[model samples]
Target: MSSETHEFKAEVAALLNLVTNSLYTNSEIFLRELISNAADALDKARFQALVDTSLDGQELESQILITVDKQAGTLTIEDTGIGMTREETAQNLGTIAHSGTLRYLEEMQRARAAGESSGAVEPNLIGQFGVGFYSAFMVADEVVVTTLSGKPGSEAVVWRSRGDGSYQVEPGSRSQRGTTIVLTLKTEAKEFLDRWRIEALVKRYSNYVMHPIRLRVIDEQGEDKDPEPRQINAASAIWARSSSELEDSDYTEFYKHVMGGFVMPGDEPFARLHFTADAPIQFHALLFVPGRAPADLFQEDRKALQLYARRVLVVENCDTLLPQYLRFVRGVVDSQDLPLNVSREMLQEHKSLAAIRRQLTRKTLKLLAELAEESADKYAKMWNEFGSVIKEGLHTDGGQRAELTELLRYRHVADTDDGLVSLKDYVAGMGEDQKYIWYVAGPNEAALRNSPHLEAVRAKGEDVLLMSDPVDEWVLQSLSEYEGKSFRSVTQGELDEPAEDEDIDDKDDDSDDKDDEAKAKDKREPSPIDPLLNLAKVVLGDRVRDVRASKRLTESPSCLVDAAGGLSRNMERILRMAQPGTKLGASPRILELNPDHPFVTAASKISETNKDDPRLAEWVEILHDIAALAEGTVPDPAGAAKRFTKVLNNLVAG
Candidate 1:
């Protein structure tokens, strides 16, 4: 029969340009696509043979054979499974049927322009778009495929492509069933003609492909020999194995193998979770929480788990398997049930995929909770290292907030120095009358523990959760309440509850009720210092949100707190510094003064004894600066220095 050349579909041309020109900088991944294709072909043949027993007892072993011809500068990957008839080869190779091609192309175009994620080929995208067959063009100048159908009397076919714009198909000479792809490596890509390079690429991308990947091994001798078959790929998927038959060391070794360079050498995994889901979706996962955080955990390229469709590695860094907060998790998600579009490159957005994600996240959080309970010291170390990342989910995922909240722990002044307490424990310890769960968030322990905002509550012997992580404030903002107790920032709002040892208990029966009188006295507003507050408010002007004598301040003269609905001072500072062009201006703060302090008493005297003393305005400004400094801010240090100089001069002159 006469051979004929056919033009590629327009979309196929675009897809070719993306792989060869933009994404295939390494070029070795072409082998992975070919091997994955071989695995797929074997799967089809195995299914057909099972249905029609007429094909039984043939050499039914499913394996992929690869050979390198150094002299010819070519690589051939041949599979022993279902081969295509001439008509089938022409039809499958000539057209693009995958619906996600346009979507994948749009994403790739954006990625290339942004210089993100464009460096590596996304295995699933290739499979989903059904363009993986054409990926060989990335490394080869010419590709030829020879195939014979596994069907009873179908003829062999040879498809040839220079991958410029056209391909040719004709009857082939192959006797047995299955397909063989031969690549005439480009001059620049001739490195793929080496046995070692082929082996390494197979191990990196397709080592776990279900079919044996047979490669001819070269020994130390310089002589060229006949092909002695050896399986290059493990051909066994780790997740497909039963948990009962596998040991921790087996899982550990598999994790290390899968993680490759992403995980640190010699570090252990914190935990491993293995399970299979039959309902909602059929999937098996071997998830591991790395013992040490990846050095690149904070980077945009943080590695994620591989996604496999039916043991054929489909997606690399399939982050949809877990949320960004759990990007540090390393493992495999193998599902025979995920409906991959033709070409197995792009997964259609199915309800089952979302359900799978929800299930995995729930199970992961449960595993962490179990670890925290069974091994507090170990989990604490993990929290100290990774809690910052976990807290991010609280701000981003509303549905998982409560689960994440329970999984979180924090160091507190209330707990022993290094120990942490959960919100549950703090709530359990709360007095029957306490209305909110109190917390103080800052940059570090020293800043938080030294904060004047915590003083009055500490004086009352009420505990406050000390949150030092920068993410803690944002997370608490998103997680407003847990189990009915609203989070109240000690640095933001007033505390109404009396001290734990205070006499509300004694007032149960009108027993002398000295505590009742004290409570009534404390309930009295800033009426005692109204004139002093008025004088300072006028002098400070818009510099302060409003001046008030604080019941929260006992040891310090003044402090700053957030407005009723506003973010905390520290949280604002963090936002302004971390984000550019934020227009955060200065956080509007209420300057609260300790009315009982000697300085305030002296300040009251100034308002009463010398209403026109210019020094009065100066001291009010000084108090504002001091509060700023105490709040860990450098608000006008030079101006504060000049003002302090004037204050010293006035004190001596007076």
Candidate 2:
């Protein structure tokens, strides 16, 4: 045997050590890695043949043949694809140029900056890093790769590595224009030597690979009959099949296969969108919104969507398919138009891939809109699990914001009696003069229903949509208007209405006499004790922006409103979780007190007599506490508790 020794870079050695010993939890992924590398090689050969007509006539039977020798305790994968020269093998295997270890490190650094905790080293990340060939070290003690380049006069080469810091590449002899990988399995990895086990893995992970996968195995014909070798994988695009032929069970089965068979007992996909596109880029996609949100969906360092090329799964949980807002989506996007050996760096810059991304995003939004229209109940259930994500899309994707708004559902006063209605339905029942869509955001239905902000709208017989979801504030902030009508937050802005709607008719001659008598009686009535209300505002100036007699407050003693443009209490919590330790600018709040309420009336009388009384201070504190609770903010618990105890002690003493 001829051999030329080569030394690996320090980082390459470290990477190899990580892959061989620390990276992967499942060793079977090595087969998938090999298959993907072989596919890439075949793709390159096809691309080369297209450019050079001389290689067109070459009988390039692009397929993978896996041979398992139990007696020899070895597994070999052979591919009829573009091979490597001696120098190429030495550089590719010994150095980390082709592999994305450098890029992976960069990504880790970026992730860390974003405050994500990347706990364990990932071996399956090999595919993402583009050095999938090295994954063989996870299961094999030694890997021997024999290759023959497609170049007219290129010499064949053999590269051998033993999970160490160095490898050897030498001139080799091979009859075909391809590569073959022989894995000398470790004692613990002897199961890979079983034909059945190897065949199952090929079907499970690499079945969608465009190349036929043949397994050398013994098929029993009879009790005394010998076994025979055969092909195990279908090697076709499963998604290209017609939906008419695909049953729900079939789709579910495929999902389980792609998702690593982690299907929960009663869980079903909330929705599925399957379609094909050919214009900008040739692609087939099967997207599913899981019935339950994954435990990792909210995890700070959650993985992204899955990405595939030519039916061969490329990246698991690939975030590139859609924006992070659509992370709950699960599916495969098989694009034949994308380059097979493209690096992630290249993918980010590819024009055609970007176009495909735009198309897929639009298609997904359309599918969700269809679901909302087709079955309101089912769609509501989906919304309960993933509605926040859709709202997030509305907040971020301005181009599709209108469509997302149409798909939005909320509980209005009318619908609340039954619970939740779409904007379209609410718009359908709007009065002729109703030009603006009114919505109120609060902590819950009860709180929103009791909100003093709704009084003016209700007095005019108008229905205000109650937005209780935590995402509602952010959604409405971004979605300022819809269908040419402005969206008005009942709690924040000035109410504008036509003069006719606000005007009250003057009393007639006979009624004028009674009105004059009533006016004389009202003039004789005592003025409201405004001193106490002013005292309350002065005492709580630090906590509140303003205290005023509220025309909107009907049943409630007090209510709260943002003094300026900013996020509501609910939105503050959501933002805090997404960006930990991020300081947000504070917005002052208006405390609106109802003059007719007994608490306020009593405080008014108390302040008039005892302007300097400590009890008046206590009453003012209590009023602020009530308003803070209504606004869903935490009040000064100690001060409020002391005031409450004094009130109770006074009642007991009386």
Candidate 3:
């Protein structure tokens, strides 16, 4: 038969140049691309054989074979699958983004719409963007494709191209069905001719391909030994199998494979969410929450979740599939609904992907909720490992705040041991007089439990949640309330006195006596602490918004509180640490004093005796500095140290 030559379409010529140079980031991607195309062809042949019994490859087992000839510096990939005819080869390969699988699916959809097709039989295939075939030019100098159509009477055809904007078509004489691609490796790409390198690329990208992928190595000593083609891929598609048939060990093994040994060999996942969804979008997933988090889990560029299309991997670390907060989740998601670009290295921004993400997030959260309810001990252990990361979701995903809140666990001020409290349990135990959910944040649980801001609350037998995680500060900023109750920081805003449960008598008889006692006490006391408060405000100047007596403080001499609707002290400190020199952390806070404390009493007496006393101003400055230190910050270390030394010297002299 005569061979014919044709120049690529002008647009295709420009596109071919892009595919060979810039389309794929790695040269090794060409192997995965070719394997995916071969797998797609195999799928089409299997589906066609069901309807047409005369197909040529119906009796042969479908598999992909990779052969390396190190002597010739060439690699060949052959598959026992459907092959293309002369016209189909030119149309499918000579163009960019013209997918054969997409066309086949469209035809099936049209058939179903016209009542010509029956049942839900669909082709499960990959290679959505036909340009995957042209990725070969990224590594090869010349490429040759020899294929024989699976159609009974169809003849074999050969396609040749140097990827220089021209291609040749010629008649082939192969007796069996399917296609074979041979690549003459360029000088720099000869590493692909090594057997170990070929094995690695296959396992990395196509380890779970539905069909067996076999490899053969022909050394310089010739093919005298190792006659049989050994299979390289697992070909199990573990996620696609029925969960009922899979054992726990099987799941663990697959998790280890997918996670690339990120977890220890014997370490089991804390929880696993395995389910198949068909309504919103068809997908099979196996998600695992590792028992221990990686050291780099919080890195900004860390990736999670492997995304696959019909068993062929589309992306190794699909960051788009899960939000950054859920980046600790490790597993595989296999779906055919996602759209891929030319290299299949990245996913296109499609509505289906968004739907998948929403579904996966809801499912993951639900799994955590179930774990917390059904298994307390196990869930507690998992929470201890990942609670800080999960708390981030409360601030980022407002829509799921309620669900996330149910998963929160915190140390309570009343807890003597390491026991944790949940919002639901805390709300149930709340006193009728308690109007808001009170919480205190500090450097550690010990510091937070002993916080002076919770003194009055403890005296009233009310429990305050203790938070020590650094992320807890930012988390509380967005989590304003849980379960119809508002969240209040014990260190923010003016402290409100808890309402007394005792009922007041309606009789007017005792009203005059109570009023007389109050008037006499007010006349005698005459607001002795008022002088100290006014003097401290003047001494501190704009460093504090106001200085006043605290209703919340009992043991501590002083504490800092932000004004109503102002940023909490802990949150401001976190912001300053994350972004140094940020102006957002410069808000002045209110300083509240405990008038009953000895230090406060002595300072008040000094101010009453003489407002200009040097000791009075030094004591006020020391109180402010101590309050700053209590909140895990240092406003002015040098000035505070000098004042502290003077106070110590005066105490010794007295």
Candidate 4:
């Protein structure tokens, strides 16, 4: 038989170039992609054999055998499954039939039309294009694929392609059915020829594939005449094992084995859910919520959950296991029922898979709730690391939102000094007529604790949950209500009347006298003092949409609260960092003051007696400046400095 080469189609050339140069940066992925394809072929064959056992004559033995020859610089992946015909090989490989390239291109066009920049949409485009097979070009200079269809009398075919945009197809003879991919490694990619390297990559990327993945590695013994190739994969699904047989350390090790990192022993998982279900689909899953959120969890380019089939690994990072909100979770999910050749698009639409996802999501949330109930300390630690992500679920996933809400923790009046408390605890501690779940959002625990907005609630002995996490405000916005209780931001809107019995009233005549004295001291007299407040508001007009006397102030002379439909100070700071150049709305805040405070009383009296005193006017300006600082806004330093000097001169002359 004579070997020949042929030119590739124009699009094939572009696809090859993309795969070799830009598709993947890691060369080891070529091994994973090939092994996954082999496992898929074996799975298909096993499915077919169940329908017609006579096709192979012998009982179907499904396995993926990988051979690496260091001296020859060649790596081979073979499988025994329903193979392909000459036409099938031509369609699958010679072109991009199985690759999701067309769909990827369509997605790219759609993304571009949706106003996404080219750079922003690039990394998210994967799998839909059939070019994954061509990713072999990332490491290999040349590739040869030999496939024999399972049907009797079907001739085996070999398809060869160089890293360049061309390929050739020819007929070959093979005794067994299935496919084999041979990669002639390039000089720089010789590491792939090492037995250890190949084994490591297999464990890293294909450990969860459904069929047995056998690697040809030299068996080490006391005496060796010649090295014989042996299988390397674990060949069994870890998820299928009983939970009792596994230790926490064992789980951590397995996570490291699949995740490819040294998982520390002290690193406790945020939440772990291990279960099996045969109903909708046969699957065994061990999912873990990391004790800490990954830096990439909120990154625009999010990684997917690792996917496994049976015990052998199919896809290293599979996004089909859970929704995007659960991206912070890391683990393996092995299913025996799903089709091996299921496409990404199909995975999205697959009802069985959807059912599986819903079940897994609920299981994960339930595990978290259990953690919170069983060990509040550990769960609180977990919330510190991943509460924001769970809060995200509370916002986006409506079905599980209620469950997620119960799992959420916050700093409330009752638990403020103690630590974090759950919504359940807050509800249990609620006063009889408390209709709304109240919370205050701020930069930190201290800020929220000192917020004037919580004064009235605290006075009534009601607990106001403190939301300090940068994500808290958004989470609250997404989850408008929980468990029939509407969530209200204490600082954003007006509060309903306190429980009737808890009303503030003077019990004695002396109490009445004290009340009158306090009112006289605290109340800002209606005089030129009002105009000074108005002048300050006008000077800071658009910067602050509105400014008014605050009823919430107690000890602090002044504080700022978000105007209607505006972000809290903490939320604004967070947004400023996340999206640069995004304009924030001008929120006029209530300039709250403690009416009975000595400084306000002194200022009111001084302004009244010396209406034309420039020093008194300067003092009035200083009071507003001080108030702005307490409210977390900086006054104009230059103006503040000038006013300070005038006040100092007046005091020195007096």
RMSD of 1: 10.0
lDDT tens per residue, model 3, 95-186: 66788877888898898899988574678877766788898998899999999888878888999899988999999987889999999989
By lDDT rank, best first, the candidates go: 3, 1, 2, 4
**Residue by residue across 436-498, what tens digits does model 2's lDDT show?**
788887667788787778887787777899887777877876877666666766776235422
Clashes counted in candidate 4 amount to 19
Best by lDDT: 3
Each prediction's whole-model lDDT (CA): 0.76, 0.71, 0.83, 0.67
Q: Count of backbone clashes for each model? A: 8, 4, 0, 19
- Per-model TM against the reference: 0.78, 0.68, 0.88, 0.69
Q: Residue 448 lDDT in model 3?
A: 80
Candidate 3 stretches with Cα past 4 Å from truth are 9-12, 94-99, 118-120, 265-267, 497-528, 534-543, 583-588, 602-626, 632-654
lDDT per residue (tens digit) for residues 1-654 in model 4: 455676766577776676667656666777777776676566556554555556662464788877776656777888886788876776667666464334434765796789863453232112344666877888888898888888777888889888576788888877788888888888998877676788788777666565677767423332322255466677656678889888887787677654447656667576677888988788889887776666677776666666555454555667767766677888878766555442221343567777778888778777877888899899888887776777777667878777877888886767646488887777777789788788887676775676667777777777888787777888877676666677777775334423212334533434543354354335445543464455546555565544455556556655556643445667777888788788875445555445556766666566556555555455555666776665455658788877778778878999
Question: lDDT value for candidate 4?
Answer: 0.67
- At residue 584, candidate 1 shows an lDDT of 79
* After superposition, candidate 2 runs with Cα above 4 Å error: 1-65, 70-73, 78-204, 210-226, 229-236, 300-303, 342-348, 432-435, 443-446, 493-529, 539-541, 564-588, 602-615, 632-634, 645-654
Model 2 accuracy (lDDT, Cα):
0.71
